[model samples]
Target: MVGSCSVRFPINLEYLHRTHPHVTTYEPEMFPGLHYRMVVPKVTFAIFKSGKVIITGAKNKMDIDNAFNQVYPILKSSIKITEIL
Candidate 1:
């Protein structure tokens, strides 16, 4: 009951910012990526403009799945269901 995972994908910062402003913060001087936290899965995700995602603080894979399920659609209206998980 301990660990985390990382994911890499492509997304636009302007869209992400437009979509989820309340849940993210970005300051290039402090960090290069946008930091986000998911409340349902209790997971933390570091989302970069390059679409590289690092998901941490998940206790199990199910949590990861839940978080992914919750986040995927927010960025994109549809699901591709490829390699990132």
Candidate 2:
């Protein structure tokens, strides 16, 4: 299944990729958004600079919600890191 949502602010893909190299993939030449994969909910998030997130591999609404909830803090924390550096 797939789900989509947007955060209130723009996201910095470079900082996200730099900070989460293990789980995030950003190849501007090949794709526009940053691809973030989570293991627990087993979902892939196509996260854009505009804060739009496309979620894939979720089985239901609950999974989607769970995945989003799990990722929100990670994204927020990355912003703090971006501010620091």
**Candidate with best lDDT:** 2
| Tens digit of per-residue lDDT, candidate 2, span 1-85 | 9999888677888988988899999999999999999998999999988878999999899999999999898777766665676
The residue pairs that clash in candidate 1, if any, are none
lDDT for each residue of candidate 1 in 5-83, tens digit (9 for 90 to 100): 3444556654565567788776667887776778888887777655667788888989888887787676453123222
Weakest ten-residue segment in model 2 by summed lDDT: 76-85
Q: Count the backbone clashes (under 3 Å) in each candidate.
A: 0, 0
* CA deviation > 4 Å runs, candidate 2: 81-85
Candidate 1 regions with alpha-carbon error over 4 angstroms = 1-9, 77-85
Q: What C-alpha lDDT values do all the predictions have?
A: 0.66, 0.89
Look at candidate 2 and give me any clashing residue pairs: none
